[model samples]
Target: MAKDYMPPSDFLRALIDEDVEIEADDTATIKRLLSFFKDPDAANRDWAVFLLGQSEVDTKAVRDALIGALNDEDDSVRAEALVALAQRDGDLARPHVLEALSAEGVYPTVFEAAALCAHPDLIKPLRGWLKATGDKEVDQMVAEAVAACEASAK
Candidate 1:
């Protein structure tokens, strides 16, 4: 989604307005965004989760919603949740980052989260992944994540 573009749905648009109004910390907006998690369209759910991730609210409701979103069917949504959670708290993001690293596929957002958290536990898996991926870009992402983890380890 474009930075300035809002979702075409009226409800989503209103939610965006409310997010802007309260700087994304309002209870009602958060509740509606949480409800949107159940939307049939993955895009809507993804967008809703993305908005929730951007929220400054640190309530248990928001954190639980982000953690729940890690199980979303869409990879991007899960990635966003991981990144958001990592940005907020390294301890909270560590296990999930390890799990994502152990997963079969290469997810760039997972690397992003790994880099953001820079926990020592991630270094081993990141080194194992180095140059193993056929995709150079992904390998580079792993390298950077490894570097971040190593720096933090030191």
Candidate 2:
């Protein structure tokens, strides 16, 4: 039997609630999340992009929203948007990825995106990141991304 469904009155709280599972076809929830992009709080925008990117909701509107978020002032938001775009459409994300990878400090999530992208073009930047970020975890991630890009080239 299908259980009764009630949407949360507090979306932000619900966003972080472990017990609150977002349904795949929940357009209302998706719409509310999209609206969060314009929120003055950077954390709200960050959560919006991160959730949308991590979701299965694939739409042109979602993609465009993610793209727009790439320009967000918050680095985390931009990184989440880039990861979402990279996961959905590598071709559309390549230029932005290259630009982001060139930044003095690339976000960890962006490295995850690079791995997902697995584009040969990302190899040089990944190599650069491997040298630049002295952290062992980040180096491991960059190595994984480089391996992914290399594997894709074959």
Candidate 3:
């Protein structure tokens, strides 16, 4: 079954416009911006979620939207959501970001999110992954994430 996608609303385009006035915390702006997550353009949806993640609107609506974005078909969008969630609520976002590690093709992004959150609980598992993967680049990422977690714990 095909899902019909609506075009981005004028309000949404204006809200996202560089020249148009942007009030990051405006309730209406936030709502309109959040709605772009359903745009037919995957890139649009991904970037919409990315910006929302970066936005200061930490309302439950925004948070829920970002969490939902963790499952977006676009890996980049999902990565942004994971990072944003981790930054917003480290303890809550920890397990999920760690889970992304097990998926294929999203290693670097997930690792970056895990590092940003610096959740101590992730250290052991990251270390385990390090030993198992044996890829020098990934090991570096894992080591950095572990260090970040350890530092945050201190």
Highest TM-score model number: 2
TM-scores, all candidates, are: 0.82, 0.88, 0.75
lDDT of 1 by residue, 1-154 (tens): 5577555556776666773443454677568778877777777877787777766767777778789888988887888889888888878999999998888885787888899999899999888889988888888888999999999988
CA lDDT, every model vs. true structure: 0.80, 0.83, 0.72
**Candidate 2 C-alpha lDDT tens digits along 19-122:** 55556688888888899987898777877777777788888889899899999998988998999999999889888988998888888888888888899999
Rank the models by lDDT, top first.
2, 1, 3
For residue 31, model 1's alpha carbon misses the true position, in angstroms, by 1.5
Compute the lDDT for candidate 1. 0.80
| lDDT minimum window of 10 residues, candidate 1 | 17-26
Candidate RMSDs in Å, in order, are: 3.0, 6.3, 5.8
Of the two candidates 1 and 3, the one with more favorable lDDT, higher being better, is 1
- Could you tell which candidate, 1 or 2, scores higher by lDDT? 2
Residue 93 lDDT in candidate 2: 88
Where does the lowest 10-residue lDDT sum fall in candidate 3? 1-10
Candidate 3 per-residue C-alpha lDDT over 14-121 given as tens digits, one digit per residue, 9 for 90 to 100: 545554443556777677777777677776676677667666668788789888887788777788788878778887788887788766545565777889888778
Candidate order by TM-score, decreasing, is: 2, 1, 3
Error of 3 at 58 (Å): 0.6
Clashing pairs in 2: none
